[model samples]
Target: MADAADGARTPAARLRALLAAAPADGPVLAPGAYDALSARLVADAGFSCVYMTGFGTTASLIGQPDIGLLGAAEMADNARRIAAVIGDVPLIADADTGYGNALNVARTVDTYERAGVAGIQLEDQVTPKRCGHMGGKEVISTAEMAGKIRAACEARRDPDTVIIARTDAVATDGVDEALDRARAYRDAGADVLFVEAPTGEADIEKIAGALAGGTPLLFNWAEGGRTPPLTLPRLRELGFSLVLYPIGTLLAATAGVRSLLETLRRDGTPAAALGSPQQMTLPGFDEFTELVGLSAIREREARYS
Candidate 1:
């Protein structure tokens, strides 16, 4: 499961496997990882795939929200690092609005394909991203998003590289419009349908059935997003193949860092309560001997020979 050398195995291959395995299973979990270390941790924890979260990356890197602060270059570098440490785990990325118009989407598809993402979820929210299930959401015309979808489909080098179309129309237009957009995107060659923020179970069931067993489905489990919370089993029963728990890691890490800082400030000494002497856990010390063990072994062999 950890090998990255098999020519026949690709991120797209892993994604297809998940699509095939979705039926009659718990919702496929794609926890968001902000950086290389977290990606490795997630892969090692036995997740089938990892999500390169935009919100986490932005806030952790520059202390900002998903308000479209990180540009294409930053996102690309982050994705490259994430792909590297996670080995060959399928990465489902957040390509927020393809980072621009249709032409930009075309380039994005090519770039992300080269970056080795198994699939990408493209939203219709006009740039300066608003949460998919949140208030004050703006959406592009169905025709425009449809055009972008077509561009992405055509730009990809691998046919199996999934193109997921996500719409914020549910809040802006209504369930009917969102469903309409999903149908149109499906017709435009999208592999998966993401009618984001369906308000209730009824609409969720409606969307699940609307695909007519054609393409796969995706959902976001944003804690405060417009969509009502549901259990993993419930989401699976509703026929969703992929679920993204984005921002959870960043939120947890933010909370922990703040707590540690508060403890240090209040006690005037974090060393006594948290880490070793001076409460800094050796503060910035990294033990490298274990990391270089293989290098040491190689050097020893050369010396001996």
Candidate 2:
């Protein structure tokens, strides 16, 4: 894993510092990025952190849905690329079901930590898990999930590398069952608790009320997902310490690409849409190059020459 600019503090240490002094007004907002370019965009936009969304990764990498299609190696390689580009910005990655049983989870944790992710979210969903918002999801037993959490905790070399425990019990069982599962995960040594896909605002509040005030809580503000969206202040008041806007970037990029393709096909030119308000919002050619660190590359080349 690459060190921060100081060359001493690792990305995990920076994330731990952020958590230690996190504000009460709002949870850390981690926007999802599918590739190194999108990860750079998130960091350049001044966000302190970025998230590697499994949904976006599966979509971008294989043009498939997030159906447990990709394995540990694929996810870790993508994490490495994003981590390399983002420099000091902490990355929180989704390690789906830890790719297998308790032993697999341990290896997944070690691999992701080495890949430079500051946090790894492991869910209780059964193997070959689909998106939390999607139907036909199932969760493993509480004991089994707790065992996974312990294995993850034991496997990480950096104690600051957070192990986030997510429960898909709300979909399979009920909110109460989800809360119970979350509590068990916490007891099993999870650094953060994530109860995935609460269908209503009431359920959201119920989750925070039940599991908050002890371990740090995570909220998934996944765009167009099953969970109802809430304002940051409301989530803060509900006691969430981290909020993930997973899939928003992917959704917006998809819409933008589709619109451009339609314009090109119809008008035989993209000039009409190029200067439109929507396109105007995008960065220009030179600005994008600078954003991607062309200046830094040029400086290095000049030094060598």
Candidate 3:
């Protein structure tokens, strides 16, 4: 029997349920989180799910771009940490190129499954894959990517853990070929299809129309990237089952930190920065402490004493 302390459903189960129900209602809007704090905020704001973005994770962890700088271990470790804090909220993580080939893809899936992610997204770009929105991207052959997708599906212990197959062929190949690659991945047992960096509305519709039949489609709402921004309803109308805002919070935090630092440098204090309502209004110190579960820690400490 399962432990009484454990919830009735595992995180994977919950995420699967969410994905299954998404098509009927609308797209599942998952905002990306770079760290535990950001994930907590995302959950606190009442989002049903979170996406662990590799781009934002690279920037947050090492202050680097998403040019495949992170290894499988680093990405898995980051997912584990974020999963620890977000409670029951589902995390859909980016697994870039599955680190290597078919065997590597299996290991990547296993690591992410153990790390408590509900979904893992693997792209078709080469081992050292660049960001989907970036230029000069190249993808592996269709058969090779299909093999990795099959490997990913075979490796996951949970049947409910979703495997997303992202094809970056829209830039290297065209939208039509990207759609063809998506079909191959779908046939290989990918739970979701992501045709990355679709340039315009027509391409987006084409992707949705071609692949959104039995398999769910994922739309990358990468702000200021190659893809044009569309509203959630518009994306839903386009038949996308999941929409990921991969760096909205990260970008906001970047701008906020810069503003605060500039204010502090100019005034020799942060008070002026905090005074404006238009400026970032941070939670009070005590509230932030509570947000981080200081009260729970104190209660446990008292019980021990």
Candidate 4:
């Protein structure tokens, strides 16, 4: 039902609808996107939620990794642009490590709330973040992360804006330690729990089963981050509220673009691409031309008046 004219609609209303319309008895599939066009594509694909992946944003925008390079302002600016086009669809943004400590988390929450994200995931990795489920992964004391969780809870303007506390201590420390931190984080008022990078099936089961009772959970389906990938149904069976396919869109786009470039090199043009505007049907082109004609009529009327 969405169209170009619907651009002026507020994000909150659309977001609410998306949240309400998610599969009633099953886990939702949320895909990650970095920019506005990708966000729109995700929405158009009938995805109920769109995740603003930190990795994708870093790599796509600045050609970097999930390190601490992108600052709050830069991330917020990018979020605003994506949220602008996606019309809410419940954006679950990746606020990696809060960009700093507890004090920084307060500011991060304030700014992200203003950017109109529906939720945020804050991790326990002590700043200067390394990928979770990877070596050299370090975590702050549970007390420190709890303080940041509290800060995040206090900072949110909307009660519905979920704060997901991600504990990276599973890889850094023992599972017991990570569980301890998750308990403290939940007690500190996180709406969801993201226990990061649980490697094997047993670990995944332990994490999922342990958190299934009272808290909602999120699972990452990254290709090679630290954990193994599972199909959507498997994730749902494990009691995950959302499964984020963070890099699949980007990977597909990257491959397509690469192929297009190679084709252009070999041939004279990217001629076989059906996705191009050149492939539009006659009626489709006519409808597009009609819109232009309507716009020109409005412009002429405005000029005379």
Candidate 5:
């Protein structure tokens, strides 16, 4: 839990401080959280930040894949909820394609800043963007994306609120095009650069070698995705500043739910599920109650009464 002084600071300010103070050798690791509960778990587990993954959010909310089904309002509302629950922990949210053009991009940035997100990731894919690792992805022109980046940067009320520009050109065009777009986005005032879904170690190295040291580089460690699962030390050595384990918490929670349902169907009790290490493990009842802030609620009630 964050102390009083930490809690008093704005999420954006806290995030800026964290970035400024982080060691070059150890990049900040932000785990994906699908909802308020999952975000709370991430915060309680002591992560420096929590990432609001559009993929997991789409799946959790609508039982659908992340093919840009949800609109800007839905994403912003989810970000507000997640930000509320995780006190003092910075939220880096995915603002897919900024929902439209430059004007729309500005509105998205404003809405996200008001939602208390510390970082907003804008990708170069079309309006209806898919997951970075998925096939059949297409990107807009470099000049268009650069304009959107400028819009996003100009729209933020808090200057410290990070504008992360992600280029998916690796899937559509090639690694060279992706690198060129990244440079353009960086020149357009993107605080962080995300070259999404590099296929191998060579691609990753090329990205770091080309774009690192000037602006922070973000690595998306999407589990079971196109990118190879590289270690933290390796990414740090490459000068990457952040790594997002998007969808890991969602996958873990999904597996736990499946196990519990299976145990109930087979044994007619949750007892066996809790008894084995291989089965679903849940926190104790009181432990979870406290984790979700029943203690704080009770304290407030007592003060009022």
Candidate 6:
């Protein structure tokens, strides 16, 4: 296993470097990974960073929605495993409302930092928080959310570990209120500010205009969600530092699986699906084994033998 001490940059350090080197006029696109294999795939595809989506993780792990079904420990363990596999590739994990209050936020930060995440995102949703893009979302008071951000900042062991504050106030209060909450979060020591589920391009531009110069802002390019989808160039033009595609891969995988299952049911075989140009080719046995580190395990076994 590759350890951080094996002449490798720590995950936090790598993340910090990526953030520092990010193009001032463009955004760093970090795609979400639900598991260790997905994280490795993200790194292999040459992404500078990876985002751990709570929605994807919950769906992949337990076939559940992103409605606060997973607790802090479960989320942290998933993050730890993903970080271990992706070694040195900075992981920005979703730490959803810190699972409770300000003290809970502190513990959540501590857990994520210890789990090797480069950044942890905390939202301002109420306890048992639903997805930001979902309806009927309500956010806590701005002062309370700001206090949680402060707690998260204070609990970080590594100064480079980013504290991202996400405000879901747009759904409840309005864009103006959301922007206000973001400013408060930034004042409370949030390293990155995210205004969740901004409905239109105008609001997106407003978020960047208001928050971009002072603090690094995050844009969510949520597919099939409330937010209007914008190109990377456009988002960068708006001055977003980090852009997260939280469920693109997950949704793609879901579609692929559904297609394969439908084809199998119709033909009673995978031959047609495998041969289709639109379908992804299945990995060979050797390639799949190597992907999971069979070669490294074999080398260790040989040394023992």
Q: Pick the candidate with the highest lDDT.
A: 5
- Candidates' C-alpha lDDT: 0.80, 0.89, 0.89, 0.77, 0.90, 0.86
Ten residues in sequence with the least summed lDDT for candidate 2: 1-10
RMSD of 4: 5.1
Instruction: Encode model 2's per-residue lDDT on 50-161: one tens digit a residue.
Output: 9999999999999999999999999999999999999888999999999999999999999998899999999999889999999999989999999999999999999889
Candidate 4 Cα deviation (angstroms), residue 177? 1.7
Q: Order the numbered candidates by TM-score, best leading.
A: 3, 5, 2, 6, 1, 4
TM-score of 4: 0.83
Error of 3 at 163 (Å): 0.3
Specify the poorest-scoring 10-residue window by lDDT in model 1. 283-292
lDDT of 4: 0.77
RMSD, model 5, all Cα superposed?
Answer: 2.7
| Residue range 1-305, candidate 5, lDDT tens digits | 23421643688877766665444336878999999999999998989899999999999999999999999999999999999999778999999999999999999999999999999999999879999989988889999999999999999899889999999999888899999999999999999899999999999999999986768889999999999999988887888888999999999999999998999999999887777554436776776798899999999999999
Residues 1-305 of candidate 4 have per-residue lDDT tens digits of 13321342545444433333333445657798988778878987877678998888988998877777888898898888888777647787888888888889989988887987887889988778855645787888889899999999898787667788999888778787888888899999987788888888788888888777666777888766778887777776887876778887888888878877887788876555434575632235556555335677878999999
TM-score of 1: 0.86
Model 2, stretches more than 4 Å misplaced? 1-8, 23-25, 276-282
The number of clashing residue pairs in each candidate reads: 3, 0, 0, 0, 0, 0
Error of 5 at 276 (Å): 9.2
Each candidate: RMSD: 4.0, 3.1, 3.4, 5.1, 2.7, 3.5
Better structure of 1 and 4 per TM-score: 1
**Location of the lowest summed lDDT over 10 successive residues in candidate 5:** 1-10
Q: Candidate 5: where is the Cα deviation over 4 Å?
A: 1-8, 23-25, 276-280
Quote model 5's TM-score. 0.95
TM-score of each: 0.86, 0.94, 0.95, 0.83, 0.95, 0.93
Spell out the clash pairs found in candidate 2: none
